[model samples]
Target: MTGITDFTVKGADGGSVSLADYAGQVLLIVNTASKCGFTPQYAGLEALHRDYAERGFAVLAFPCNQFGAQEPGDAAEIASFCSLTYDVTFPVFARVDVNGGSADPLFDRLKADAPGVLGTKAIKWNFTKFLVDRAGHTVARHAPTTKPEDLRAEIEALL
Candidate 1:
């Protein structure tokens, strides 16, 4: 019965970040890549974060290089890209592997809690998003093609 709060992730600064600190908030956890085709979605994600933050909503981004080496930058480089390109205010975590044996524990749990299309647990691409409710339950799994703006309704429901 473990939920997201049971995990710890690395911050952009490479420090440990406890998921428990986000208790009572609705979260959109995304696997991102700086050089991917879907990289522009960061703007939409930031929009969602800005529009709903006061309502206890957040967008937690985790950069990953597993997808075609799309995110090859180091921590500082990734942070700089996010800030300069998208003006992202939400938390952008340290680089992590979102698939295979080296995947981050948090991402592994998320995929398990909300499997992809046809019950497949494997993530297809970068920008894949997992929506979590206030109780830390993963409510839905969104494909990379699912735009952030399209999630407003669901986010509102959770709020």
Candidate 2:
């Protein structure tokens, strides 16, 4: 079965990043948008990254414009917004479609592995998170409204 390590994603800086690079670390993969209602969640995500990074956890942000054109920005703009607003230090991937035919392959696998409410594979909105264990297996899927801070216990368990 395809796991996190089986996919490659592009970073906001135009460089290719393989999930294998993050292998052996618990990952909170989130679909983000700078202008969405959940935009403020970036702070909580950054906090999680800072708080658990030394213990082998990471928050991988992937900007998405699919929801409402809320993330209408280029890579530079996305990176800048994340840094200036939330002081995000974790990796931010290139803007991607989280649902539909154009969705990133990595997200495709994630949704397949951990379908959301009612067994729906489609990602409902921004800030949707997929928790991946140290072995690269997706363990849980959190809805957009699930705050990042609420995931502390799960993260700690994985760590």
Top candidate by lDDT: 1
TM-score for each of the candidates: 0.98, 0.98
lDDT of 1: 0.95
lDDT (Cα, tens digit) per residue for candidate 2, span 1-159? 767987889988888888898889999999999999999999999999999999999999999999989999999999999999889999999999989999999999999999998999999999999999999999999998999999999999999
Error of 1 at 63 (Å): 0.2
Residue 21 of model 2 has an lDDT of: 89
Error of 2 at 13 (Å): 1.9
Instruction: Spell out the clash pairs found in candidate 2.
Output: none
Candidate 1: give the clashing pairs: none
lDDT tens per residue, model 1, 1-159: 978977999998879999999999999999999999999999999999999999999999999999899999999999999999999999999999988999999989999999998999999999999999999999999999999999999999999
